[model samples]
Each structure stands twice: as structure tokens, then as C-alpha cells.
Target: MASSSSSSSSLNFTVRRCEPELVPPAIPTPHEVKLLSDIDDQDGLRFHVPMVQIYRKKESMAEKDPVQVIRQALSQTLVFYYPFAGRLREGPHRKLMVDCTGEGVMFIEADADVTLDQFGDSLQPPFPCYQELQYEVPGSQEITNTPLLLVQVTRLKCGGFFLAIRLNHTMCDGPGYQQFLSAWAEMARGATKPSIAPVWRRELLMARDPPRITCNHREYEQVPDTVKGTVTPNQDDMVQRSFFFGPLDIAALRRLIPQHLRHCTTFDLITACLWRCRTKALQIEADEDVRMMCVVNARGQFNSPLPVGYYGNGFAYPAAVTTAGKLCGKPFGYAVELINKVKGEMTEEYLQSVADLMVMKGRCLFTTVRSCIVSHLARFNIREVDFGWGEGVYAGVAQAGGGSFPGISFFCSAKNGKGEEGIVFPICLPAAAMERFSQEFNHMLRNKNQPQTTSATLIMSNL
Candidate 1:
């Protein structure tokens, strides 16, 4: 999450941008409104999520201008993914719908004085001047009646470019957005249509007739909005930093687990480790429940698997909770088990319950009390996209958590400075916790002899 040279030096650049304009589909789309599923209209996804993809220059394509190619590709791509060109509108009962108006999405062309190499070895999250890279049109940040997609392509000094896109989270989840993006890339490569067709079966994920709440959805449960200690930091005090877990780092984590539980995924292992380290760094009181939420792609969870190109929100946030004391005091397996349980319990019925709860609660936001949410974009095929220039060097979320709140991190599949394949996840904490987290996290990877710290043990005695 830490920006390389983002804060340190006198690194400076001026971005010259053209006036933003609306880009519509090359072919006309039907003019009608499409109702969004309960999951899509949830409170948590009511804003635009920004992403940045850095593409290095390709000698073979030196003559072509990426800006023109991408801009044209986006126009052609929108013909099939037309909903992205529409504006979202809210209906009665807080439901959301897209007015399939061909008004188009916001697009801008720009050139930056800095080259890709000037950004240094890492181009991960917490990118410097991210807002400039993915500029928001005056009222485009508003939830309704605005462009569902905001795109800005800034050519770098070395001929490489940064393709920045901000899509309404309500329109699509990780997979959905990736599908749309890959199609755009295909179009840029002169493909008349996407290799895989896009589908708008939002109705498939809609709440069952006479919605019923079956599962106990703790992720969204409203609780006392309290923080007893200085564990949770103010938005201003938070700092972003990323940690890369290569194959060796993962092997080290697995060493702590029993052979049976070692079958758990790299995500489970790392999330558990992070939750424990963060909880220890926070020093949250024992007996106080600390929560961790994982964004599970529920496409296959349905009895009938979701269509491949059905680009809608197909993920669910299932939460795992345990007291901070137990989390930090117990062995690493304790945290891993909690995560495993949350993953195992999610089913089609569970997703339906989430839908029911959304309507019943009038679209309440996910619970934030003593909690942090983690979303993984590693398998979204970000690095596979090619706009003729070729696959990007770095492609993922533009930044860590939103400015309003902290503790939200993203997992991206990337190589380290040493070019080792692994997962790179970024975390934002108050300066003090950040230092402690870095020290402990590095200590874990470097020295296996050091015992896991046992703190807040007294609180473990309580229920």
C-alpha cells in the first residue's frame, strides 16, 4: 500500500488532460431500464471503485497511439456491454435500476510528464496522484444518474500508458468488471465481438418471490458503533503499505499449521495471519469481538452455476468473528479455522438470506465495528489484458481503502522486486500499528524461532 517515492522525493509531474466527453456505444442499444438485484443495490456498493493498469511500451506497436485505440475500443465494446454506458437510478424501497440511455460514459485523454520507470520497482496500490490518473467528472462521483464507467488514459513519457477506470461497484463485482475489461481489450485488438458473449441476467440473482431470511448474516448485523481503544485509527492518521508473500513466505506460514489444515488456500492462510498480526498490533481488549470479512465469489455456490459472462455482482461477504484476545493469544491455527468455517458455510441459501436481509434492513451498510474487509483481485485476470501494447506490468485497484474508512485491503497477484511470483496485499493502519505490523510481519517471515507473542491472555478467560 505504501507508495514508492510517493511521499519521499521531489518527484513531480504535470498531467495535461483533454476536456472529458461522453463516449457511447458504436451501435445503438435498446432504450429501457434494467432492474438491479438486491445484491447489486446494497449499501456497501453505492460508489465508484477506481482501478489503474500500467502498460509498458511494446516496440512492435510503436506507431499506434494507445489513447486512440483504447478510446475507439471502448466505444465498440459498449455495444454489447451497454449497461455501463447507462446511468443508475433508484426506485421505491431503495431498489436500483439502470436507465439504458445511450448518454454514454465519461472518457478523457491525457499525457503525463513521468515515465513508467520513474514510478520505481513497485506500481501497486496507494498509487501517487491516483485521483489525477482516474479523475472523476464534476458530478460523476454521485451515486445516481451519472456515468457508470469513468475512464482516463494517460500516456507516459516513455510511450507506455496508464489506463485508469472507475466503475460503479453496484454495476459489477470483480469478475463482472474483469469480463467487461477483457472484452474492451479484445475489441481494441480488432475483434468485432467478445470471445465470450456478455449476459445481463441480473434477474437470476434477484431475491426469491416473497424474500425469506434463512441464514444469520453477521457481516451486516448492526451493533454498537464503538471502539474502546486507539486500535481503530482516524482516516487522517492511516498510512498505506503492501507486503508481498512469495512461495517461500507462504511455505513459512504453512509451517505453523498442522498437515490437515494445510490444505486451506493461500488466501485463508494469509488472511488469518494478517488478522492475527493486525489484532496484536491493535491491542484490542480481550472479550471484545473483532471481525474479518472475506469477499467470496459465489458464482459456483449456486445450484446452477452463474453464466460465465453474466457480469453482475456475484460475490458475497461472509464474516468471521472471534475475540481479539483469543485471536492473538491462540496459535495460528485458531485464526485459520475461523476463516475456514466462514468459507465452508456459504451456500446458495446463504446468498439468498443476504438478499432478504438487504430488503428487510432497508439497505444497511456492512458492519464496521472492530472490523476490516478484504477483497481479492488476484484471479481477475488483470495481467492478461492486452490493448495491442500487451499485458500490463501492474494492473489492479488504484488504492487501498477509501479515504472515509480504513482497514479495507486488496490482494493482487504480482511478483516482488526479485521477480518471484506471489500474492501482494496492502494494509492501512495508524502509523504506530503500521510500524508494529511491518516489524512483526517481516519477523514472521525471517525468523521462525521467535515465539508468537502472547498478549491479552487474561481476557481469554471470559466467554
Candidate 2:
């Protein structure tokens, strides 16, 4: 099958192999195993995170076939991360486990007729037929029958290519998926061993006794099994936009904060600014309780810490909550302090207590409409995944139209040809509110001396 747009075109290439294989071929039988931790158990349901990477052509890679190399490396890399090649199944006690059946990942090859330059500068506000770049699987199928991972490598007319990957969130989190990509790239470079060897120790995160409930976990409230009188919004009115925050832009925002709070991390400041702007854009009620939900990595929080390559969901969703009036009306430092306090609360005991509480309740915590979920991908070196080609010109998550939640944002580190450091924010909002959001966000960044708005509105529209 093939799909095309005015700027870019793609043709799907048939794949030959789909069975998982072990490189060494000496390990024990790949039997079905239970996911020991409740953290993994809660997310075992089928949900996928899609990512796309756009790489400019390297002259040396012009003649080499990327498809063959990627396929070979993927096959070898699966020997270590073999669970990715397996299926999700309901184990005893209604828990989800991996059916390690050696069923391989879905791999597809594609060709794009457009040059990299013609494909537009931002991967957000995705081009028409962007869905063609991502591998597709039937949505109605049982979770056990679906492939855990799907990859599509599209070669462009300019010799550059786009690599799109969709991984089942039930099987791994962001860090885990990055590890798999890094390992595969290493194999593609003909390295015998990956830089970090993977460790499967899910038992280490087992739930504690008596289900300890410590500090107020207001961020993670349980949803009732049934609901009535809930209204659904019009999905068609939603729009996804990407904003670029250059080094200078970020520094300006930092300068606005008090000197005492200046020591806050970049993630802290950027997220604080976004939370305030997003809340204002929605024109939410002053008294409405709003939240900034962030996914915290628990790997390093534990006393011993998880193994470097423990591939599972080792993260916690910690949120900072305040009424809209308080959050927007307060100084920027207030939000930063709230976020920092939440970060400090993610100690080993807190995580253990959370796991215990989840086990006792038999349900995962849920979010509400007032919550703005923010994920930071700046730390992950996704741009460094080199498979014969030079580093990618741009790489980030794939954002589809119409399915966007009102206040979700992802921050990523980006660089252009000039090597300037920049942060890219992919934000989703109701189409009607985008203009107002652009105005407010830009105003927050403007200097007090500047009498007028700069090119912020123009930049936002182009996004």
C-alpha cells in the first residue's frame, strides 16, 4: 500500500521475516513469565507511544542499504530484549504477563519521494499522510495477538530517511525503549556487545506488606468503576502545535524568576511556564483545581536503584496540584516549589507505599480533565542513534491530529545545522484556544522593556 501528500510521499515495502531469534542460541527455553511488579502489571493493558526520527543524508551512507542493516541488527538485538517479541497475556490473579512466544516485531520498509527539505521544518503539526510513516496494526485484535513493537523505516528521495517506531507502553517505558534503540544501533555498527547489558529483574519491585499509605497521594485518585452524566467534548476541534524555545528564550524565562529560585533546573522552569500559560489559555475557572502531572523516573530513587537496563515501567506519576486562581495568580517560584516538593517526595519508601496501595486497591490511579501532563525527553540521547547515517536532523514523538488531549505537552532537545541549543515543545489544545495561548505564552517571555510583541505570534502560527 502507498500514501502521498503534497510535500511527501511514501510506499510500503513488504517484509520477509517476523519470527524472533536469539543471537547466541544457547539460552534456556523462552517460556511465559509473569511480570512480578505491580507497576508493570497496572500498565499491561494495550497502549502504545509512537516516535519518529528524521535523519539527513550522509554521503557515505548513500550506497549502503539501511533496510537490510536495520533488519539484521533488530533480529540480533531481540535476543537480549526478547520480551519485546512476545505477546501480552492475562496471567493468574488477573495480572498481565508476557507470553514469550518468539513472535517477532512488525517491520516495514518505505520509500518517500520528497527530499528532506520539502518535508517541512517541524515534525509536530505533522504533515498530511503522516500516519503512513507509522506501522499500523489492527486495533480490534486481542492484546495477545498484537505485536509488542512495530517499526517503519522510510527512505527519502534526498537519501535521508525517517524511522518511526511504536512500542507497547505495557512492555516498556521511555527509558527502556531508548535502551532497545541504542542497543540495536550498536549492533548495526557491528559491535558484538551492547554498551549496557539488559537485566530482567522485575521481582525487585514487588509490592510491600499491608499496603502502606503514607503521605497524601492526592495526584493519584481512584476512578469509580462506573460513571453517569459525564459529557464528552468535540474531538474535531483539537489541534496539536509545536513551539521552539531557543537557548536565549529559555535564559530569558529564567531571568524572570527570583534569584533564590534561579537554581531550579531547566525542566522545572520550562514546565512551570507551560503550566501557567496552558491554564490561562483554557480560560479555566479561577477556583477549578488544576494539576501538572509529571512522570518521575524511580530507577535512581530507590536506595539500591534498579539495574541500568531493567526494561520495564520503573516510573511514577507525581503531580503538583493547585486551584487555577492560585496557580496562575502566584509567582512563578510557587509553581517551581510545588514541583520540587513533589520531586523530593518520590523517595524509595514513597514508591514502595504507592505499589502497596495499588495492590490493595486493585486499580491504578487516574487523571482528570484539569490535569496537564508534561513529559521531558530532553535527557534522552535519541538524536545520537546513528545507523550508518549521521545523527538525525530532528527526532521526537509522532503527534497525530484530532486525538489530542487539551493540555498535554512533551519537551525535547533539538539542534539545527548551526548547532544552537533549543527546546521543542509539542503541545495539544483546542483549536479555538490556540491563538489566545500563543499570545499569552509569548507575552510571558517578552522583556518588560519591550513595548510590543515580537515574532512570537508569527512563529506560533507557522508551528
TM-score of each model, paired residue for residue: 0.93, 0.87
What lDDT tens digits, residue by residue, belong to model 1 across residues 167-274?
789999989888888999999999999998999998877777788889878898777866552335444676777777777777778788888797899899889988
- How much is the lDDT of residue 195 in candidate 2? 90
Cα RMSD, model 1: 5.8
- Residues 329-379 of candidate 2 have per-residue lDDT tens digits of 988788877876777767777777667766776746445556766777767
Cα-based lDDT for every prediction: 0.80, 0.67
Model 1 weakest 10-residue run by lDDT: 454-463
In candidate 1, the residue pairs with backbone N, CA or C atoms under 3 Å apart (3 or more residues apart, or in different chains) clash, namely: 1-241, 1-242, 2-241
Weakest lDDT window of 10 consecutive positions for candidate 2: 223-232
Best candidate (score: TM-score): 1
Error of 2 at 9 (Å): 14
- Which candidate has the highest lDDT of all? 1
